[model samples]
Target: MWAELIQEVRVAQTGVQILFGFLLTVVFQPKYGRLADTDQAIYIVTVVMGACATGALVGPVSLHRLVSGHRVKPRAVRLASRMTLVGLALLLATMTSSLLLILRVATHDGYVPYLVTAVVAWYVLCWYALPLWARRRNRGGSGD
Candidate 1:
Protein backbone atom coordinates (compact mmCIF):
# COMPACT_ATOMS: atom_id res chain seq x y z
CA MET A 1 0.00 0.00 0.00
CA TRP A 2 2.79 2.37 0.88
CA ALA A 3 4.49 1.78 -2.46
CA GLU A 4 1.26 2.22 -4.33
CA LEU A 5 0.44 5.41 -2.44
CA ILE A 6 3.89 6.79 -3.15
CA GLN A 7 3.59 6.03 -6.83
CA GLU A 8 0.19 7.72 -7.04
CA VAL A 9 1.49 10.78 -5.25
CA ARG A 10 4.42 11.02 -7.63
CA VAL A 11 2.12 11.22 -10.64
CA ALA A 12 -0.16 13.80 -8.98
CA GLN A 13 2.78 15.82 -7.71
CA THR A 14 4.17 16.28 -11.18
CA GLY A 15 0.84 17.42 -12.58
CA VAL A 16 0.13 19.89 -9.77
CA GLN A 17 3.62 21.33 -9.97
CA ILE A 18 3.27 21.94 -13.68
CA LEU A 19 -0.15 23.54 -13.28
CA PHE A 20 1.00 25.74 -10.42
CA GLY A 21 4.00 26.88 -12.41
CA PHE A 22 1.83 27.94 -15.31
CA LEU A 23 -0.55 29.78 -12.98
CA LEU A 24 2.34 31.66 -11.42
CA THR A 25 3.34 33.09 -14.75
CA VAL A 26 -0.12 34.39 -15.71
CA VAL A 27 0.25 37.61 -13.75
CA PHE A 28 3.33 38.58 -15.67
CA GLN A 29 1.80 38.07 -19.07
CA PRO A 30 0.87 41.21 -20.99
CA LYS A 31 -2.70 40.08 -21.53
CA TYR A 32 -3.25 39.66 -17.83
CA GLY A 33 -3.65 43.41 -17.42
CA ARG A 34 -6.65 43.47 -19.73
CA LEU A 35 -8.66 40.85 -17.87
CA ALA A 36 -11.66 41.93 -15.83
CA ASP A 37 -11.45 42.04 -12.05
CA THR A 38 -13.71 39.01 -11.76
CA ASP A 39 -11.46 37.07 -14.05
CA GLN A 40 -8.47 38.14 -12.05
CA ALA A 41 -10.14 36.94 -8.89
CA ILE A 42 -10.87 33.60 -10.47
CA TYR A 43 -7.26 33.30 -11.52
CA ILE A 44 -6.15 33.97 -8.00
CA VAL A 45 -8.44 31.33 -6.58
CA THR A 46 -7.32 28.86 -9.19
CA VAL A 47 -3.67 29.47 -8.40
CA VAL A 48 -4.33 29.05 -4.70
CA MET A 49 -6.08 25.79 -5.38
CA GLY A 50 -3.16 24.60 -7.47
CA ALA A 51 -0.76 25.46 -4.70
CA CYS A 52 -2.83 23.59 -2.15
CA ALA A 53 -3.08 20.59 -4.40
CA THR A 54 0.66 20.57 -4.87
CA GLY A 55 1.17 20.66 -1.12
CA ALA A 56 -1.26 17.89 -0.42
CA LEU A 57 0.05 15.66 -3.18
CA VAL A 58 3.65 16.20 -2.12
CA GLY A 59 2.83 15.83 1.56
CA PRO A 60 3.35 12.07 1.48
CA VAL A 61 6.97 12.49 0.52
CA SER A 62 7.58 14.74 3.47
CA LEU A 63 5.65 12.43 5.73
CA HIS A 64 7.79 9.48 4.77
CA ARG A 65 10.97 11.45 5.27
CA LEU A 66 9.94 12.63 8.72
CA VAL A 67 8.66 9.27 9.89
CA SER A 68 11.16 6.94 8.29
CA GLY A 69 12.08 5.39 11.63
CA HIS A 70 8.98 5.88 13.75
CA ARG A 71 7.51 2.42 13.17
CA VAL A 72 4.29 3.99 11.88
CA LYS A 73 4.53 3.07 8.22
CA PRO A 74 0.98 1.74 7.88
CA ARG A 75 -0.67 4.72 9.54
CA ALA A 76 1.47 7.18 7.66
CA VAL A 77 0.68 5.43 4.39
CA ARG A 78 -3.06 5.63 5.08
CA LEU A 79 -2.87 9.31 5.98
CA ALA A 80 -0.79 10.00 2.90
CA SER A 81 -3.31 8.22 0.72
CA ARG A 82 -6.07 10.42 2.14
CA MET A 83 -4.00 13.51 1.49
CA THR A 84 -3.39 12.45 -2.10
CA LEU A 85 -7.10 11.89 -2.62
CA VAL A 86 -7.90 15.34 -1.25
CA GLY A 87 -5.23 16.83 -3.45
CA LEU A 88 -6.78 15.19 -6.49
CA ALA A 89 -10.17 16.62 -5.58
CA LEU A 90 -8.74 20.09 -5.21
CA LEU A 91 -6.89 19.66 -8.46
CA LEU A 92 -10.13 18.73 -10.23
CA ALA A 93 -11.78 21.92 -9.02
CA THR A 94 -8.82 24.02 -10.05
CA MET A 95 -8.57 22.54 -13.50
CA THR A 96 -12.31 22.82 -14.09
CA SER A 97 -12.45 26.47 -13.11
CA SER A 98 -9.32 27.21 -15.03
CA LEU A 99 -10.84 25.68 -18.15
CA LEU A 100 -14.07 27.58 -17.59
CA LEU A 101 -12.26 30.86 -17.27
CA ILE A 102 -10.11 30.18 -20.32
CA LEU A 103 -12.97 29.06 -22.52
CA ARG A 104 -15.12 31.94 -21.35
CA VAL A 105 -12.39 34.31 -22.35
CA ALA A 106 -11.55 32.67 -25.65
CA THR A 107 -15.01 31.80 -26.95
CA HIS A 108 -17.44 34.06 -25.09
CA ASP A 109 -20.29 31.77 -26.06
CA GLY A 110 -23.42 30.79 -24.12
CA TYR A 111 -22.42 27.12 -24.24
CA VAL A 112 -19.24 27.62 -22.25
CA PRO A 113 -20.93 26.91 -18.97
CA TYR A 114 -22.50 23.74 -20.24
CA LEU A 115 -19.26 22.57 -21.75
CA VAL A 116 -17.33 23.21 -18.55
CA THR A 117 -19.94 21.50 -16.44
CA ALA A 118 -19.88 18.48 -18.69
CA VAL A 119 -16.13 18.23 -18.46
CA VAL A 120 -16.24 18.54 -14.70
CA ALA A 121 -18.80 15.77 -14.48
CA TRP A 122 -16.62 13.61 -16.67
CA TYR A 123 -13.69 14.17 -14.38
CA VAL A 124 -15.77 13.20 -11.34
CA LEU A 125 -17.00 10.01 -12.92
CA CYS A 126 -13.63 8.99 -14.22
CA TRP A 127 -11.61 9.89 -11.17
CA TYR A 128 -13.92 8.90 -8.37
CA ALA A 129 -17.19 7.18 -9.14
CA LEU A 130 -15.86 4.24 -11.11
CA PRO A 131 -13.19 3.42 -8.59
CA LEU A 132 -15.62 3.73 -5.67
CA TRP A 133 -18.16 1.48 -7.33
CA ALA A 134 -15.57 -1.13 -8.16
CA ARG A 135 -14.24 -1.08 -4.62
CA ARG A 136 -17.69 -1.46 -3.11
CA ARG A 137 -18.61 -4.30 -5.41
CA ASN A 138 -15.37 -6.15 -4.83
CA ARG A 139 -15.58 -5.73 -1.07
CA GLY A 140 -19.22 -6.78 -0.86
CA GLY A 141 -18.54 -9.99 -2.76
CA SER A 142 -15.86 -11.09 -0.32
CA GLY A 143 -18.44 -12.68 2.00
CA ASP A 144 -17.17 -10.90 5.10
Candidate 2:
Protein backbone atom coordinates (compact mmCIF):
# COMPACT_ATOMS: atom_id res chain seq x y z
CA MET A 1 0.00 0.00 0.00
CA TRP A 2 2.85 2.39 0.72
CA ALA A 3 4.43 1.71 -2.65
CA GLU A 4 1.15 2.04 -4.45
CA LEU A 5 0.41 5.31 -2.68
CA ILE A 6 3.83 6.66 -3.57
CA GLN A 7 3.29 5.76 -7.20
CA GLU A 8 -0.02 7.60 -7.23
CA VAL A 9 1.54 10.61 -5.53
CA ARG A 10 4.26 10.75 -8.17
CA VAL A 11 1.68 11.24 -10.91
CA ALA A 12 -0.22 13.93 -9.00
CA GLN A 13 2.97 15.69 -7.92
CA THR A 14 4.17 16.06 -11.49
CA GLY A 15 0.93 17.60 -12.61
CA VAL A 16 0.63 20.02 -9.69
CA GLN A 17 4.25 21.08 -9.95
CA ILE A 18 3.84 21.89 -13.60
CA LEU A 19 0.67 23.84 -12.91
CA PHE A 20 2.24 25.77 -10.04
CA GLY A 21 5.24 26.61 -12.20
CA PHE A 22 2.97 27.94 -14.89
CA LEU A 23 0.99 29.95 -12.39
CA LEU A 24 4.18 31.52 -11.13
CA THR A 25 5.00 32.75 -14.61
CA VAL A 26 1.57 34.17 -15.28
CA VAL A 27 2.22 37.06 -12.91
CA PHE A 28 5.13 38.21 -15.03
CA GLN A 29 3.09 38.38 -18.19
CA PRO A 30 2.18 41.86 -19.38
CA LYS A 31 -1.49 41.03 -19.69
CA TYR A 32 -1.60 40.30 -16.00
CA GLY A 33 -1.52 44.01 -15.29
CA ARG A 34 -4.53 44.54 -17.49
CA LEU A 35 -6.73 42.09 -15.65
CA ALA A 36 -9.60 43.46 -13.62
CA ASP A 37 -9.46 43.41 -9.85
CA THR A 38 -11.84 40.48 -9.60
CA ASP A 39 -9.90 38.50 -12.16
CA GLN A 40 -6.67 39.27 -10.38
CA ALA A 41 -8.21 38.05 -7.15
CA ILE A 42 -9.18 34.82 -8.80
CA TYR A 43 -5.70 34.46 -10.22
CA ILE A 44 -4.21 34.96 -6.79
CA VAL A 45 -6.48 32.33 -5.32
CA THR A 46 -5.68 29.92 -8.13
CA VAL A 47 -1.96 30.38 -7.68
CA VAL A 48 -2.18 29.86 -3.95
CA MET A 49 -4.26 26.73 -4.39
CA GLY A 50 -1.81 25.40 -6.96
CA ALA A 51 1.05 25.99 -4.55
CA CYS A 52 -0.82 24.19 -1.78
CA ALA A 53 -1.66 21.27 -4.04
CA THR A 54 1.95 20.94 -5.05
CA GLY A 55 3.05 20.85 -1.44
CA ALA A 56 0.44 18.27 -0.45
CA LEU A 57 1.21 16.03 -3.40
CA VAL A 58 4.92 16.18 -2.65
CA GLY A 59 4.43 15.60 1.06
CA PRO A 60 4.38 11.80 0.94
CA VAL A 61 7.94 11.66 -0.31
CA SER A 62 9.17 13.92 2.42
CA LEU A 63 7.17 12.00 4.97
CA HIS A 64 8.71 8.75 3.86
CA ARG A 65 12.23 10.09 3.90
CA LEU A 66 11.87 11.56 7.36
CA VAL A 67 10.13 8.53 8.80
CA SER A 68 12.31 5.85 7.26
CA GLY A 69 13.57 3.43 9.97
CA HIS A 70 11.15 5.01 12.45
CA ARG A 71 8.98 1.88 12.65
CA VAL A 72 5.89 3.88 11.71
CA LYS A 73 5.16 2.72 8.20
CA PRO A 74 1.46 2.15 8.73
CA ARG A 75 0.88 5.46 10.43
CA ALA A 76 2.95 7.24 7.82
CA VAL A 77 1.04 5.63 5.00
CA ARG A 78 -2.29 6.63 6.48
CA LEU A 79 -1.16 10.22 6.92
CA ALA A 80 0.31 10.32 3.45
CA SER A 81 -2.90 9.02 1.99
CA ARG A 82 -4.83 11.77 3.70
CA MET A 83 -2.41 14.35 2.35
CA THR A 84 -2.81 12.95 -1.15
CA LEU A 85 -6.55 13.19 -0.94
CA VAL A 86 -6.33 16.79 0.25
CA GLY A 87 -3.89 17.48 -2.57
CA LEU A 88 -6.32 16.08 -5.10
CA ALA A 89 -9.13 18.21 -3.76
CA LEU A 90 -6.92 21.29 -3.89
CA LEU A 91 -5.87 20.37 -7.40
CA LEU A 92 -9.50 20.22 -8.39
CA ALA A 93 -10.10 23.67 -6.96
CA THR A 94 -7.01 25.05 -8.69
CA MET A 95 -8.07 23.64 -12.03
CA THR A 96 -11.58 24.95 -11.65
CA SER A 97 -10.36 28.42 -10.71
CA SER A 98 -7.86 28.44 -13.53
CA LEU A 99 -10.61 27.46 -15.97
CA LEU A 100 -12.87 30.16 -14.64
CA LEU A 101 -10.15 32.80 -14.99
CA ILE A 102 -9.28 31.71 -18.52
CA LEU A 103 -12.87 31.65 -19.69
CA ARG A 104 -13.68 34.96 -18.12
CA VAL A 105 -10.66 36.58 -19.74
CA ALA A 106 -11.04 34.90 -23.12
CA THR A 107 -14.78 35.00 -23.80
CA HIS A 108 -16.14 37.48 -21.29
CA ASP A 109 -19.42 35.68 -21.65
CA GLY A 110 -22.15 35.34 -19.05
CA TYR A 111 -22.14 31.59 -19.61
CA VAL A 112 -18.67 31.19 -18.18
CA PRO A 113 -20.04 30.35 -14.74
CA TYR A 114 -22.31 27.72 -16.17
CA LEU A 115 -19.50 26.22 -18.19
CA VAL A 116 -17.24 26.15 -15.15
CA THR A 117 -19.99 24.54 -13.15
CA ALA A 118 -20.39 21.80 -15.71
CA VAL A 119 -16.69 21.15 -15.79
CA VAL A 120 -16.54 21.00 -11.97
CA ALA A 121 -19.36 18.45 -12.05
CA TRP A 122 -17.43 16.41 -14.56
CA TYR A 123 -14.30 16.53 -12.42
CA VAL A 124 -16.24 15.48 -9.33
CA LEU A 125 -17.76 12.59 -11.21
CA CYS A 126 -14.46 11.39 -12.60
CA TRP A 127 -12.30 12.00 -9.55
CA TYR A 128 -14.59 11.05 -6.70
CA ALA A 129 -17.87 9.51 -7.74
CA LEU A 130 -16.73 6.60 -9.88
CA PRO A 131 -13.99 5.39 -7.55
CA LEU A 132 -16.31 5.61 -4.54
CA TRP A 133 -19.00 3.73 -6.41
CA ALA A 134 -16.55 0.97 -7.30
CA ARG A 135 -15.26 0.75 -3.74
CA ARG A 136 -18.79 0.43 -2.38
CA ARG A 137 -19.73 -2.12 -5.00
CA ASN A 138 -16.73 -4.30 -4.21
CA ARG A 139 -17.05 -4.04 -0.44
CA GLY A 140 -18.15 -7.64 -0.05
CA GLY A 141 -16.31 -9.19 -2.94
CA SER A 142 -13.21 -11.37 -2.98
CA GLY A 143 -10.06 -10.25 -1.21
CA ASP A 144 -8.40 -9.66 -4.54
Candidate 3:
Protein backbone atom coordinates (compact mmCIF):
# COMPACT_ATOMS: atom_id res chain seq x y z
CA MET A 1 0.00 0.00 0.00
CA TRP A 2 2.84 2.40 0.81
CA ALA A 3 4.49 1.61 -2.48
CA GLU A 4 1.24 2.11 -4.37
CA LEU A 5 0.63 5.42 -2.62
CA ILE A 6 4.11 6.58 -3.56
CA GLN A 7 3.58 5.59 -7.19
CA GLU A 8 0.23 7.35 -7.45
CA VAL A 9 1.61 10.47 -5.80
CA ARG A 10 4.48 10.62 -8.26
CA VAL A 11 2.15 10.77 -11.25
CA ALA A 12 -0.17 13.42 -9.80
CA GLN A 13 2.74 15.36 -8.36
CA THR A 14 4.43 15.80 -11.70
CA GLY A 15 1.25 16.88 -13.43
CA VAL A 16 0.32 19.45 -10.80
CA GLN A 17 3.84 20.79 -10.60
CA ILE A 18 3.97 21.39 -14.33
CA LEU A 19 0.53 22.99 -14.33
CA PHE A 20 1.31 25.24 -11.40
CA GLY A 21 4.53 26.32 -13.04
CA PHE A 22 2.66 27.36 -16.17
CA LEU A 23 0.02 29.16 -14.11
CA LEU A 24 2.76 31.16 -12.45
CA THR A 25 4.10 32.26 -15.82
CA VAL A 26 0.77 33.57 -17.09
CA VAL A 27 0.95 36.61 -14.85
CA PHE A 28 4.21 37.68 -16.42
CA GLN A 29 2.79 37.58 -19.91
CA PRO A 30 2.14 41.00 -21.45
CA LYS A 31 -1.41 40.14 -22.40
CA TYR A 32 -2.20 39.34 -18.81
CA GLY A 33 -2.39 43.05 -18.10
CA ARG A 34 -5.00 43.50 -20.79
CA LEU A 35 -7.44 40.95 -19.43
CA ALA A 36 -10.74 42.13 -17.99
CA ASP A 37 -11.33 42.25 -14.26
CA THR A 38 -13.51 39.18 -14.31
CA ASP A 39 -10.88 37.32 -16.31
CA GLN A 40 -8.25 38.35 -13.80
CA ALA A 41 -10.43 37.06 -10.98
CA ILE A 42 -10.86 33.78 -12.78
CA TYR A 43 -7.13 33.55 -13.28
CA ILE A 44 -6.54 34.16 -9.59
CA VAL A 45 -9.01 31.48 -8.56
CA THR A 46 -7.57 29.05 -11.06
CA VAL A 47 -4.09 29.70 -9.74
CA VAL A 48 -5.29 29.04 -6.21
CA MET A 49 -6.86 25.79 -7.29
CA GLY A 50 -3.62 24.84 -8.98
CA ALA A 51 -1.76 25.59 -5.77
CA CYS A 52 -4.17 23.44 -3.75
CA ALA A 53 -3.84 20.62 -6.25
CA THR A 54 -0.09 20.81 -5.98
CA GLY A 55 -0.23 20.62 -2.21
CA ALA A 56 -2.69 17.74 -2.08
CA LEU A 57 -0.79 15.77 -4.71
CA VAL A 58 2.42 16.29 -2.79
CA GLY A 59 0.87 15.61 0.62
CA PRO A 60 1.68 11.91 0.76
CA VAL A 61 5.38 12.60 0.84
CA SER A 62 5.11 14.88 3.80
CA LEU A 63 2.65 12.52 5.44
CA HIS A 64 5.00 9.60 5.02
CA ARG A 65 7.92 11.54 6.33
CA LEU A 66 6.01 12.50 9.45
CA VAL A 67 4.65 9.02 10.10
CA SER A 68 7.36 6.75 8.75
CA GLY A 69 8.12 4.78 11.88
CA HIS A 70 4.67 4.74 13.38
CA ARG A 71 3.63 1.45 11.76
CA VAL A 72 0.56 3.01 10.17
CA LYS A 73 0.95 2.19 6.52
CA PRO A 74 -2.66 1.25 5.90
CA ARG A 75 -4.13 4.36 7.46
CA ALA A 76 -1.56 6.58 5.84
CA VAL A 77 -2.28 5.07 2.44
CA ARG A 78 -6.01 5.68 2.86
CA LEU A 79 -5.50 9.28 3.84
CA ALA A 80 -3.10 9.89 0.99
CA SER A 81 -5.55 8.34 -1.46
CA ARG A 82 -8.27 10.69 -0.25
CA MET A 83 -5.91 13.64 -0.64
CA THR A 84 -5.11 12.56 -4.18
CA LEU A 85 -8.78 12.46 -5.04
CA VAL A 86 -9.25 15.94 -3.64
CA GLY A 87 -6.25 17.13 -5.61
CA LEU A 88 -7.63 15.70 -8.84
CA ALA A 89 -10.96 17.37 -8.20
CA LEU A 90 -9.26 20.72 -7.66
CA LEU A 91 -7.18 20.19 -10.77
CA LEU A 92 -10.35 19.60 -12.77
CA ALA A 93 -11.83 22.88 -11.56
CA THR A 94 -8.59 24.72 -12.25
CA MET A 95 -8.35 23.38 -15.76
CA THR A 96 -11.96 24.17 -16.50
CA SER A 97 -11.68 27.77 -15.34
CA SER A 98 -8.39 28.23 -17.12
CA LEU A 99 -9.94 26.96 -20.34
CA LEU A 100 -12.92 29.23 -19.86
CA LEU A 101 -10.75 32.29 -19.42
CA ILE A 102 -8.52 31.45 -22.36
CA LEU A 103 -11.37 30.72 -24.73
CA ARG A 104 -13.19 33.87 -23.69
CA VAL A 105 -10.15 35.98 -24.33
CA ALA A 106 -9.24 34.32 -27.63
CA THR A 107 -12.68 34.09 -29.22
CA HIS A 108 -14.88 36.59 -27.36
CA ASP A 109 -17.71 34.19 -28.07
CA GLY A 110 -20.96 33.97 -26.15
CA TYR A 111 -20.68 30.18 -26.00
CA VAL A 112 -17.65 29.98 -23.75
CA PRO A 113 -19.59 29.06 -20.61
CA TYR A 114 -21.53 26.40 -22.44
CA LEU A 115 -18.35 25.04 -23.90
CA VAL A 116 -16.76 25.04 -20.48
CA THR A 117 -19.77 23.25 -19.08
CA ALA A 118 -19.54 20.55 -21.71
CA VAL A 119 -15.87 20.12 -21.01
CA VAL A 120 -16.52 19.95 -17.29
CA ALA A 121 -19.11 17.26 -17.85
CA TRP A 122 -16.63 15.34 -19.93
CA TYR A 123 -14.04 15.57 -17.21
CA VAL A 124 -16.47 14.43 -14.50
CA LEU A 125 -17.54 11.49 -16.61
CA CYS A 126 -14.03 10.48 -17.54
CA TRP A 127 -12.38 11.09 -14.21
CA TYR A 128 -15.01 10.36 -11.60
CA ALA A 129 -18.04 8.61 -13.01
CA LEU A 130 -16.26 5.83 -14.81
CA PRO A 131 -13.99 5.09 -11.93
CA LEU A 132 -16.89 5.11 -9.52
CA TRP A 133 -18.84 2.77 -11.73
CA ALA A 134 -15.92 0.40 -11.85
CA ARG A 135 -15.57 0.49 -8.13
CA ARG A 136 -19.23 -0.27 -7.61
CA ARG A 137 -19.10 -3.16 -10.03
CA ASN A 138 -15.98 -4.59 -8.48
CA ARG A 139 -17.31 -4.31 -4.96
CA GLY A 140 -20.77 -5.64 -5.70
CA GLY A 141 -19.83 -8.59 -7.87
CA SER A 142 -20.91 -12.10 -7.02
CA GLY A 143 -18.90 -13.90 -4.41
CA ASP A 144 -18.25 -16.64 -6.96
Output the number of the TM-score-best candidate: 2
Per-model CA lDDT versus the true structure:
0.90, 0.96, 0.90
Q: Count the clashes in each prediction.
A: 0, 0, 0
Off by over 4 Å in 2: none
Better of 2 and 3 by lDDT: 2
Worst 10 residues of 3 by lDDT: 135-144
Model 1 error, position 81 (Å): 1.3
lDDT of 2 at 52: 92
Residue 136 shift from truth in candidate 2, angstroms: 0.3
Given candidate 2, what's the lDDT at residue 119?
A: 100
**Candidate 3, residues 15-129: lDDT per residue as tens digits?**
8899889999999999999999999999999999999999998898999999999999889989988998898898898889889988988998789889999999999999989
lDDT of 3 at 117: 96
Off by over 4 Å in 3: 140-144
Please state the error at residue 74 of candidate 1 in Å: 1.7
**Clashing residue pairs, candidate 3?**
none
How much does candidate 3 score in TM-score? Answer: 0.91
- C-alpha TM-score for every candidate: 0.94, 0.97, 0.91
In model 1, pairs of residues that clash are none
Ranking, lDDT, top scorer first = 2, 1, 3
